[model samples]
Target: VMGLIFAKLWSLFCNQEHKVIIVGLDNAGKTTILYQFLMNEVVHTSPTIGSNVEEIVVKNTHFLMWDIGGQESLRSSWNTYYSNTEFIILVVDSIDRERLAITKEELYRMLAHEDLRKAAVLIFANKQDMKGCMTAAEISKYLTLSSIKDHPWHIQSCCALTGEGLCQGLEWMTSRIGVR
Candidate 1:
């Protein structure tokens, strides 16, 4: 009985531990989304030069999330954080149609990395509240999300400022965690 109690306590204490990384182009609202998840409110933020990290708990699951800087020069350093990440949240600027290709390039590059082979991807089609933004389906097509056969992935339309659609995205994440 004592051993069973200890095992249950340990699982409860650790929960579904995961190392999650959020990455995208600069101005894609990665920080805002992180703040929304952390505080459920918008937090004023500037361009992240390196990364912003926080512990987020959802559905009793605990995970360390790293919101990496998305500037062009900072993109090369993203791999340094990939060691044990189990989930990848790729935020897309739904309104920046011009940069969708670049986003695709980065997504493909990250997915191609050996360290990320098993990481499940969560693509946030952010800025849904903006006018003239692309739809999630369109963005998915442009990003060729369908071609990714090795890793599990999902795309969610969201407005980080209002925290809309974020719950659904997180639900998918937690469910994925449960499966693992």
Candidate 2:
């Protein structure tokens, strides 16, 4: 009886489904990343006004994926939902060099939040299929990822249009969340 009780308690306290929040500037391919992971197809693109939530299960792990809008106005509303998130996926347009700094600032602000300090982060340098796109290393440098070097995360490159590198990003994220 004691053995069974201990097993039940251990199960209860073991790693649970991790909640992941996906955010980025408008047209950064946040939704496309999610769609590609879920449906394995790139859907029509549009700005996500508020947010889109999806539950994805792989193996024994479940992921509550929240794709949040990237508009400045929408950011105020984003704080409310960050409370329970265990991980974050930030997408950036690889071709938009001009706005890269702005994107970095926004992401920095989000990571500075006390509630999110411990959360794992995965940055998706999306739109790699486009010409003149920046590489993951360049995006990491521009975003000053080294500042958060102590934080647990990885910045991955991806081409959501053709689904290149999408699975690799997902696997990296899931691994960090103890989802293996």
Candidate 3:
């Protein structure tokens, strides 16, 4: 009975909630990463039309994550959901070197939005399992992350298929947001 009471009291005070959005070019594995977090397994995904909102608990903190569609036509609508975002996950297909310029452009545009100026940014360099994929450091340089000063940012190399580096990224995000 005493232990149960302590558990109840701990739950009352230990949970924190945060809002995060995952944005990137199409086929960057945002949905796969989301599934990995939610289901602990990979789920085959088609291109998202608008967005997928889901809640996940990491380190005892509840995170409401919005996985937004990254198609060129849908990119313009991303800002509409940024108003209350606390963290931004920008996934990049490390093997898609040809489209890095487009990714860079879209990323900078999102960062320029007033609502996200104070949000923590986590760049997931996805597809690291693919041959000749860029490393997280290279992606950061390609994206010119050094130029971003308004938000705390991190670049994590991740392979959604095998679930490598994903938790570290979330842990980094939670740390940046002061959750842990």
Candidate 4:
């Protein structure tokens, strides 16, 4: 088992890397969603400060996911990772109840960045298990990227608390990236 682990680690160090940048507004459950995707286990987490990275392989496609800090204060430093990103995952806490508009605006601004426009975008409408939360459709409507041509996007409803919708979202996202 240890040899297998070493072989995997060795291969990772020698492989060509594919990266995905995960961004969202503060307290949007971005970290939770990332933990679920990476660790496959629920974990207690506070807001991120700058960023954290997790290496994962799904169906032999290696992924380097950068979970960037969502706080307004930390967002100013996001530009450092804009290049070489193949995908962008934006998570929003559906039950947050007040920041939906702000989330949409922030995401729009990120998408508008010249270096990021070509990145495949995926929106995770998180906390879908909560009552009175917006649906994926509602979130997309507010994002207003509905008619953006030449770019691909998907809005997936997920409950990070229970892992519901996470696998589906990841599968959809990876499939899109594979074709890109």
Scored by lDDT, the top model is: 1
TM-score of each: 0.95, 0.89, 0.91, 0.87
Task: Tell me the tens digit of each residue's lDDT in model 4 across 1-180.
Answer: 999999998777556467888898888887787788888888899989988899877777677999999888888888788898878889988887588787877777777888787888888999898889989888877777687665688889998888899888779866775475
Give model 4's clash tally.
Answer: 0
The lDDT per prediction is: 0.94, 0.84, 0.91, 0.83
TM-score (C-alpha) between model 3 and the true structure? 0.91
Could you tell me how far off, in angstroms, the CA of residue 80 lies in candidate 2 after the best superposition? 1.3
Order the candidates by TM-score, highest first: 1, 3, 2, 4
Best by TM-score: 1
Q: Which of candidates 1 and 3 reaches a greater TM-score?
A: 1
By TM-score, how accurate is candidate 2? 0.89
In model 2, the runs with Cα more than 4 Å from the true position are: 1-15, 178-180
A best-first ranking of the candidates according to their lDDT comes to 1, 3, 2, 4
Q: Which stretches of candidate 1 lie over 4 Å from their true place?
A: 1-14, 178-180
Mind giving the per-residue lDDT tens digits that candidate 3 earns over 1-180? 999999898876557668899999999999999999999998989999999999999878789999999999999999999988899999999999999999999888888889987888899999999999999999999899999887788999999999999999988977776542
Query: Which of candidates 1 and 4 is the stronger one according to lDDT?
Result: 1
Compared with the true structure, model 4 gives a TM-score of 0.87
User: What is the clash count for each candidate, in the order shown?
Assistant: 0, 0, 0, 0
